[model samples]
Target: AQRVTQPEKLLSVFKGAPVELKCNYSYSGSPELFWYVQYSRQRLQLLLRHISRESIKGFTADLNKGETSFHLKKPFAQEEDSAMYYCALGGRNTGFQKLVFGTGTRLLVSP
Candidate 1:
């Protein structure tokens, strides 16, 4: 079985402050981790993937297999960055791609 856990339900930060959203996972086989964000009244979109090793909108997440974690981080928080962030795990299940998502962490950026 595979699972993703996001301990914090809400994270509040002020503009220009650093932000970190923690995520942990458990899986038997190799896992693919991803970060997804959903803005207010908008559809969910992929923020970054561990395999890509790229940063989007100033957010980045690195897969730490030894620690079984994939934490999202940003140098600075912006008011427009406020949104719902979800950590997802992807792997092959019976020859098909299976994705397991965490409950998610809501980010609130204040001015």
Candidate 2:
């Protein structure tokens, strides 16, 4: 079965610290990986996608097909960067592609 794994449930870091949210996935075929984030009072939204190779809010993620991993990274953390991040995998199950979300990682940035 295809699965998305986020081992860390809670991560704490100080302001201006480098942060990395680990994510690993398992699937049979090519997958479209994405990083979704939800701020304190905001709705869940896309942070970035593998194909875009773009960075949103100083965060970047590269999909490693060989390792089946798409890890989110941020050079410097900020208080507002604190949020719940989710790693999602878009893969074909039967007839269409479906999104499989990880458990989620709650990042807390301390001042």
Model 1 global lDDT (CA atoms, 0 to 1): 0.93
Model 2: per-residue Cα lDDT over 3-65, one tens digit each = 899999999999999999999998888788989999988999999999899999999998998
Worst ten in a row by lDDT for model 2: 90-99
Per-candidate TM vs. native? 0.96, 0.94
List RMSD in Å for every model shown: 1.2, 1.2
List, residue by residue over 1-111, the lDDT tens digit for candidate 1.
Answer: 688999999999999999999999998788889999999999999999999999899998889999999999999999999999999999884137767899999999999
Residue 71 alpha-carbon offset, candidate 1, angstroms? 0.2
